[model samples]
Target: MKTLLFCMLGLGLTACGSSPKNAHSNQDELAMLVGTYTNGSSKGIYTFRFNQETGTAVPLSSAALPNPSYLVPSENGKFVYAVSEMNNSTAALSSFSFDKETGELRLLNTVPTLGADPCYVATNGREVLTANYSGGTMSVFPLQKDGTLAPADTLFQGEATGPDTIRQATPHIHCTVFSPDRKYIFATDFSADRILRFVVHPNNPIPQTSPEAVDIEADSGPRHLTFSPDGKFAYLITELSGKVIAFSYNDGRLKQIQTITADTVAARGSADIHLSPDGKYLYASNRLKEDGIAIFAVNPENGTLAKVGYQPTGIHPRNFNITPNGKYLLAACRDSNVIQVYKRNEVTGLLEDTHQDIVVDMPVCIQFGNYSARTKDTKN
Candidate 1:
């Protein structure tokens, strides 16, 4: 009779073994690793603690750094590089040490941008690249071991020579980014309507000058550029012309393949462009047409794009980021002072508003970092 009772208990345990609690536990772990951003005052930087799961954010601390507009994390996630959009002739890039555990930022050092009103920055390995919008130049800086930025090593002044007085009066280097292979540095010049590419040397702090830069169509005003995950194609968004151009990239060369209007309506423009991690979707932000995001589906075989409709964001979505897991998107609506959240549909390449927003003053950027395994194991 005791053996019979034991056999019955084992059968019961095998019949109902699924655990809903374990599924919920995994979801909770996902939310803890999301990062958050806050606006530094016109002359400062703000920090925040991010709850990755529920899209909740809270201010952590603030540091005074003049006109901080853009932030780029170091390769190791230990430092954040920012640009001060100062009109002063000596505007610079500032560095901060980031506490991954606390989401706090401590001022590290500043490096001269060698240009005025430096607006955007990007990090490649141990070097920092900056684009000065007002000064029409690009600069490269070395990153020190302790999360500080060394002085600028290379400065390239953009030149504009055209008849279009309104748009091409002078050079405006708007954005700087590196290729996926880290072999080339690409800088988008708005006033010059060109995408300049430089060959990067492993030991050099600055990219070596290359004669391979590609000039886009006149008055297109290329603002931001990104490559597909496979690096087979490149996409560029123009701020002035409201166009999204696709190019075939082969062996570090770009050849224009197609151009489509980013504007759903007749005359609107875009601010930024980003590719989905899976390389199936492309997104561009429209600022003039009442704050909307344009979605495009990429054709893998030909590297072309098809319209995937648009979604309305908050007012003036200056910059946005897709979470690492590709589950959510956060848009930094600069004017509304809110970072709006959206759930992304992987199958359809569409976004649905989550109705959850993080309020901060003049927030302009959003980024993500993965939590360490030890922290995850302990359930932080």
Candidate 2:
């Protein structure tokens, strides 16, 4: 009865035993994982078959859970970790084992995030980390051999406040990003306007190194950070200021080199950031007044950004990602209830809308994984 109720609750959100077979094996099929806000039509994590060659996608299956607003797959693509962005004590982190052949996600376990409204999750196959937004903390969970979480080791954000009276009243850790080498974890605090780095210790339950930090401009609201494919450069996108800060990374240190304007919309709510597979271009999503993606040309020599173009998107494009081959870019529009697909121009590094969108309620985060050896790229 519980299973039946779950299916009913998801309704059009998921299909039972309806995953597609491995057709066209000659072509590269990558699994696209989408995590959504579940207040509306969305149920939980949605899976799809994305053809790397054709740049097309088809829905596969869905896992019915609470608001998994952000998700990250294990390095080996065997397990996925998701955050339940609920309020207060209801917030939690979930683990699932993925089946590539069937495009299914089997629930492994659930554990409290030790914080509230966890907005981001990351894992290096050794431990899982979550950035809890409302609770002003971060949590680390050691991975068991069976791909389940042991207990959580929480790290308090340690008293941070920004200029915004209401939004920056306290520490709000927006994202926990793993370094390219997987030896360090960086957490961005939106309300705090700071980025803190922690050393990873597989043997120790807590973070080490006293946690080095870099502060942003007052009220800039640092949201998310991404690294270049080669890990030589790091880019941080700020929400309030709508600026992209370029940094040179070495060992485990980040040094700011440039700050460029990406989204200057009246209600600047810049969200996610990513680089193309080739690392020639960068894209940042902006919300509120003008919902679109800002395209910037990455200076390969200096690690700076120059505004190239902008593509208007559905609504509230909180998160988006590029394909492994860098042929297509998908935007998960949270308010528009669809994932817009766009074709990439290799020579110019601009985006052209394909008009092919996948309809799902309140889709926010998009990730590409469960890849075959031929279509896999570990940069993201």
Candidate 3:
């Protein structure tokens, strides 16, 4: 019955009268793991189960850790990597072996990030990368074959600073992400106002850091980045200036092409950026003063963005994710301790609140994966 409803919806027949509960019947159970700051009622990381067909979710299980502020699962889904967002002279990245079926996690190992206040983590199935905010460096850890993280392999430290007196007094590496093709890595430095590019060398332990860095507008604190599905374009969100910049990506380099403000009335605390799976739209979050998501329509021809609209959200939307099926958007409101779920309109690229909020204290990151209800042992 759910399969038939899904087929009808795919055929553009809304009159088929399919209910939300049956929307995801054709797909496997959608599992989401949320990372949160530990200062509130939250302990560490929490898991939630959802029906993609119904666009709804409920909390499942949680594991205790210290300041698990950022998380990224391995490419094969066998492991989850998280960063201890601390600033007591040093920070660490912890590894966990994930059990997809039961939504459980076991601690594998933890290694010093060789820096202070590590904020972001990314991997290419072999190496784990982290961005240290206070230390102004990027830490690299090699992932062992058995889901553990090796000791620090390298630390790429930045020496530059931007024009902002208070915020840009020193370097602050905000995010570390890889190109979809896995050929390059991009690290955004907020205080330096630059995005450093590196060529991925799977054979060598460390990446070959490029000498040329992409410099954004002087005071724009480049925070996070997302690449278009086609890999021809990339979008960057600046935290200090509340702006989004569109760039042309090719051969391990970025060239800025366009710039736009995320919100004129909001404080400059732009946090995260992600593109729709279909590559038709881009979404960015605004924090601090105005809590909302600013939407933009992607121009397929020129890799540019046009402001479409904005949806107000809970306080401090630190991170968010668009469902793989492109039917929903989930925003993790850090300050409000709730995850706001919204239904996505594919045709217009707009969002409408579903009013299905998953309450978890100080939620900072949200990621989606698939799990098997039958076997509970399905890999990835």
Candidate 4:
């Protein structure tokens, strides 16, 4: 019954040596690391050398693993972490030592998530968290001094249900992430249609704050969330409703302020959501009935979203990313086995296909490593 939710749910950086001098720079070279589902031809995690200068993505290397469906690099670019989306008791989370220069991943350590079918992993260089879809729990692990993971500190479970009997019968924790300030952890419960909030410290595991979590529209199936650049607002994408809801943020409490539809064809299968680096636009990808990316112009004043347009994507765009420079958009189409590249219109917030795609097997997550070869003086 839980394995079916994966198919039914529709979907869904850096180095210690040198810090990202600035968010955007004149250098246009970037390293794109991709995580994939290994049931297909994908071996594990793969890499591509992207040249935003020429709009091309060239295959680099890949590491073998069971099913590294999601990947997150450490803040200093020293290590990378991935969730093995497995259903058996062997389900676990793996850590890898990253070589920024070579764009390679070396398996560091693997630890049990203490839950089944772990689908999401998040880290802030201090603690690592995984949200297990089937087990309905969020597993917490301490980040070792050497980048390895400690034994599970806790397996927090949710017991809330929404109005829908079938999809919201039990807790389905989809995504867990730390807020920008690193003071709070937000975990989304899909079946509960709620976003769980917790207070966390550098040396302490997250403690559920008062009021526990925030309830979105019943049966909305909240999947993922991202905070505004200013940390004054939060945007949540509902997988079941295919809508993006905006909320004002104050001292860890999120107040719902606005909601906008993310798909015109259907109200389901909304996969991933992200904001542009410039914080001027919001984008969410939808699978199933509408395999496209929803574009929204962000109201800088009130943090509201106005649908601008929709760009058709490859089949099942489970995840995508914007280049660090905020000039290109990469859509990882899971079923199509290709990552489509597009030239982003900064002014209009629209994406135009660049026709330079990276072919891979079941590319579900796309992340850009902070490694760049070009110097600051390099020409774009």
| Top TM-score model | 2
Better of 1 and 4 by TM-score: 4
Q: Candidate 2 — worst ten consecutive residues by lDDT sum?
A: 1-10
If both were scored by TM-score, which would come out higher, candidate 1 or candidate 3?
Answer: 3
**Candidate 3 ranges beyond 4 A from true positions:** 1-28, 371-380
Per-residue lDDT tens digits of candidate 3, residues 268-318? 788999999999999999998878999999999999999999999999999
Model 3 lowest lDDT segment of ten: 1-10
In candidate 4 the C-alpha lDDT for residue 56 amounts to 67
> Which of candidates 1 and 2 is the stronger one according to lDDT?
2
Look at candidate 2 and give me any clashing residue pairs: none
Residue 344 of model 2, lDDT score: 93
Best by lDDT: 2
Residue pairs with colliding backbones in model 3 are 23-53, 24-53, 101-376
Winner on lDDT between 2 and 4 is 2
Q: After superposition, how far is residue 24 of candidate 3 from its true place, in Å?
A: 5.4
The lDDT per prediction is: 0.72, 0.83, 0.82, 0.81
Better TM-score candidate (2, 3)? 2
Query: Which pairs clash inside model 4?
Result: 14-77, 15-76, 15-77, 16-76
Give per-residue CA lDDT, model 1, range 82-148, as digits (tens): 8877778658788877665555678778777889878788887578888998889988888776767
